[model samples]
Target: MSDAAIHPTAIVGQHARIGKGVKIGPYCIVGDKVILHDNVELVSHVVIDGNTEVGAGSRIFPFASVGLQPQDLKYHGENSRLVIGERCTIREGATLNPGTEGGGMLTKIGNDCLIMASAHVAHDAIIGNNVIMANYVGIAGHCQVGDNVIFGGNCVVHQFTRVGAHAFIGAHSMVDGDVIPYGMAVGNRAVLTGLNLVGLKRRKFDREEIHKLRAAYRMIFASEGTLRERVEDAAELFKGNALVQDVVAFIAAASDRPILLPRNGPTLD
Candidate 1:
């Protein structure tokens, strides 16, 4: 309220809820419905519009556009929200959009995410905590990205795709399918290349757990059995191993996108 530091050049709406210690820099525009939590900072030239809530301790760099209207043609001025969680860093020129009524009316980004410069997160996407999107990454609407996922620069994900936890997407990839947890995907129309063994090790995953996951992955992708049959087999074989079972369950679950598989394997779709 009174303690907030609002630059004279900024145009913050009278109805905007500015929390304690918040800072609004020069030439920024905050829409009437925006709720900025404590200690949030918007660098110069940032624009946050629409029905949006930015959590505490977040910093948005100069020229970043947040909480803008969805790009979807079907959106018709419906009441929607864009929620960004705490400790996030939205770099310069990044655009984060609100949701449309067609897709749950919400676009949410979890805590501690790093969205690099020029990255675009479209409407209705739910990004998990600790995620990192490198420069120029574009995530289409309704995509679900799991926690700790990493996207390389210029990677583009198709709408409604699901990328599981700890997955790695290589630069310049065009991903149109589901990537399982701990998987590594690369190339145009990305395919499952292998497990993210490097990520697993970096995150301190146990060596034996990694071994079991690798074995389950091979069995699931083996050429001898149908995809469904292989999934079931892996489910039964790795029943007690959560790491392996996570992958098996992701495959078993119903999704709008097909599961990404190795290029050498059957698509099974």
Candidate 2:
């Protein structure tokens, strides 16, 4: 379009589809299979390649690399796609890789996500809306991250893990298991320390609901009983509370990795 602004230093491939009012700044390289939706802004030195589709009003900062080939050793140059939703902010040096042949050939990021600088979203990661990944966070391949999840700086999520909605992961945590909804996970191995009380309160969760969830957390992790025993007790005690029920269901549905157990004191290990 005539009103669309593209700097002379940028390289837009012949088959690339750039929408109305899109702005490409200096030294950006948009590949042939890429599609940039309306009002999207690409800052300097960004490279958007592969079969990537960027939605409207999104912004890519300097040195970000989106939609590259999957890093999986099993990837064999198969056709894949990376879909980024509207109004998303990808900060400088963020790298989002496409899916591998084994991972369904698609990686997705939902609307309004703030992916901070130097964050890495590996092959086939599916991130839901309103997610905030802080600086240098690393999400491994095929991880499913739910809506409104907040990952602190330098957090590392292992492959095939699921982070449920409204979960808050503290900085430098290494998450290897599924994170339950409304939970706060912290420490090196990412233990479910407690309910994300402050975050829930900020999100307008009622005080009564918070109390119920806190009670559920106490039964799940703080109590002296075994995990199976705790779940059985929680089923009887907190059946009326939907949030508590969700936590119980989460524990029941966990397959390989168990939820983190609470320690007696604040030990890093």
Candidate 3:
């Protein structure tokens, strides 16, 4: 609450708003239009740019770049914003860019997410709550990563792709299309191997729900039936389960780039 509590070595711009009980370490740069909510902590050498807002209880480590300008060529310097929700942890050397002119004007990270060191969240990306981005993971522009999703180290998510809730992406994989909820995807160009049974079990999914998801995966990825036929079959079989229905719909609606097929199975083509 006291101005003396702020490290004199840190440079807080005249227009910057520092909240009560905030702790800013030495040599940190807090720019104008930056708002640090209650009890936030900025470690040494952190750079929080203008138009950036850090919510309550978030901790930004040293050398991390929070709310910088968009990397897009079309940005044109439009005063876009970057908003980090409450209680998130941004590790050292992480770079989170703001939104571009084309993809709205805000890049957002939800509450309680853990963004590991050296991770890059590009312009206009939306990361949901409880998502884990392991070290060196790169999320490209306009990507929408759902809640509770886990990305192993060095995973690269393509632009405009949607990774559904509870999906698990293995290390060193490349995600180009939409990853369905509760699915396990791996490999260089990630493929859906099967239901994320381990994750589902850890999340305490009931047996019936797991069974339904397995059945849906079989119908969509393993069946000999045409895409339409497989979708119809899955629709009938998984009528009551919304998660299964979402998988079915995602597979059916996928165009240009379909979800990855299982590696060990017979080819669907």
User: Evaluated with TM-score, which candidate comes out highest?
Assistant: 1
lDDT of 1 at 47: 98
| 32-100: candidate 3 lDDT, tens digit per residue | 889999989997899999599999999999999988777788888888989998999999999999988
Return the number of clashes found in candidate 2: 0
What's the distance in Å from true for residue 161, model 2?
A: 1.5
Clashing residue pairs, backbone N/CA/C < 3 A, model 3: none
- Sorted on TM-score, best first, the list reads 1, 3, 2
RMSD vs true structure, all candidates: 2.5, 2.7, 2.7
The candidate scoring highest on lDDT is 1
- Model 3 is weakest, by summed lDDT over 10 consecutive residues, at 260-269
Position 268, candidate 2: lDDT: 22
Model 1 poorest 10 in a row by lDDT: 260-269
Ranking by lDDT: 1, 2, 3
